[model samples]
Target: MITKVTYLIATILSVKAFPQNIQLLSQLPSDPIEQPDSWAWGRHPKEGFGYKARNSLTLEQCIDNPETAGTVHCDGYDYSYPVELCISMPRLAPLKVCADAKFPKDFCVSNAANMVKAKGCQKFLTDMCIMDISLATSQPCADAEFPKDFCVANAVKLIKANGCQSYLTDLCTADVSLAVSSDCAGVKFPASACTSNANFAILDNCKGVEFPASFCTTSVQIALLDNCKDAKLPKEFCVNGDLRMIKAKGCSKFLGDICSQSLELANSADCLPAQKSVSVFRCTRSRDICLSQLCELKVRDKGSCPQ
Candidate 1:
């Protein structure tokens, strides 16, 4: 009898000799032709559009060759694996950078302005004013550190060039008290302070936006619309640290499946009665049916769904 150690050594030798010939596959084994049950195996429909077969290798033929494996058998076997396997996908540009066009133009300007201020690149304020602010903000600035006084002066130059002198004057006037008093220590700047400084542009809930999660980030102008404050949603769907839950119910019409805006619909009368949730059908036969009937509903409706 071949000991386990002997079998392992043999396998290693075989692998080294025919490394390129071995092919692995994901399919389970079919029963022998002589078994009546072999003819009764269930069938599935042809793959639908966009369906991709899992990436796997086939090693049956390689192992069956006597020259490759003298006595071991590798075919006509079925095994269920506990762990899932997947092929590595090639790296691609991040969706946030590539999909910036899909978002509001203001977001680009806001993002660019943030980068400029974050890096303390006061000397480039004039260059930034003439260049594409949208693209500039997507990448880090080359030189981000500079003297605070220089940055302050350069910021004034930017505000003037960007047609924001009056706005800055008003803001600085209003903020003078905070700057001088103890409140200055606790005052938190807005996320888009640079853009707001330049043109009074600010994105509401800017921190909450994420690609494929929320359709797009919204502004305070949209959130403050009628009944926006009274909207409510289940606690589970709310993003932590978001102060926008009160407007969720009212803003549900504008959000996507994975965003904070969708949380607003958690309290909809239609969903309240249905005990079935998207989470319940995750890993069973019911999952396919549930996805086909319900989860797709949300996707088809662009987020105002699962009702």
Candidate 2:
């Protein structure tokens, strides 16, 4: 049942994905972004004119590196570029074309031509960056009495039966899991079911489900530590002790670092941590992500940041 697709390699540049060379794309003009939703990235920037553009730039990345990730572009849409990969960059090349042509249509579409050949490949990469940690992917997102088999699949089925576009966002975005058993807090599956999970093989069949903050509780915190353990613990955890070291995993600086790469080790955790100890695992992973971003940037934007 595994279908393989053809892919094209886009050879060029690095992976540090910079948003754009243009002032608008890179930095907002005013604080609060002056009704950010009104901007291109806004979900409802204008009445009957906005379509969730939060990670529009990321979408551009997907189009640029369809070869690396695997995907195809659909002709015609707001997206001027081809919809190639999940990690897409914003459209710059097509924007110019549309601007010069002075067409009413947005060029984000045709602009992103899929270099890769995999179906749904674009979404897979997007999930990695935007919605990477999902509870539906694993067993017992929280300690519960739910039967072992009562997994994301069942939840998907129930949700679809009820009729809904979103069914799993509640499972993975929480500061903690809410259900005591296999019951999925009434989340219904969308028409896009299997569209995400089937596409992403990395997490098996639990893609496209993003729980808010309810799933990030102490148990979830510990779970985050476990994930960090697998990825390569921060230097703080390695030195202070491993994730299970109670304190290391006890919502301490070490734990925070694992949950958020943005979070650095506290001053108390280590002085001159950079010189004292840098996480080999983190450094390597970050570099890899950085590389992916760079390559995506080069091909998608034509030597310039995606517009």
Per-residue lDDT over 36-121 for candidate 1, one digit per residue giving the tens place of the 0 to 100 score? 22222221333211212221223455323323221223223332111111001101111111211222233323444443342223
CA lDDT, every prediction?
Answer: 0.32, 0.29
Q: State the local distance difference test value for candidate 2.
A: 0.29
Compute the lDDT of residue 52 as modeled in candidate 1. Answer: 20
Residues 1-307, model 2: lDDT tens digits? 1231121111111111212321132444443412454335321222212223333334456445433232222121234333332224323322321222221112222322321112322222222211212422322122212222232335443222222123344332221232222344334333233123322111322333432222322233332433223333334433343333333332333432332242232222432333223333433344332223222322243323222
Model 2 residue runs over 4 Å out of place are 1-161, 165-181, 185-226, 241-243, 246-307
Clashes of 2: 54
TM-score of every candidate relative to the true structure: 0.18, 0.16
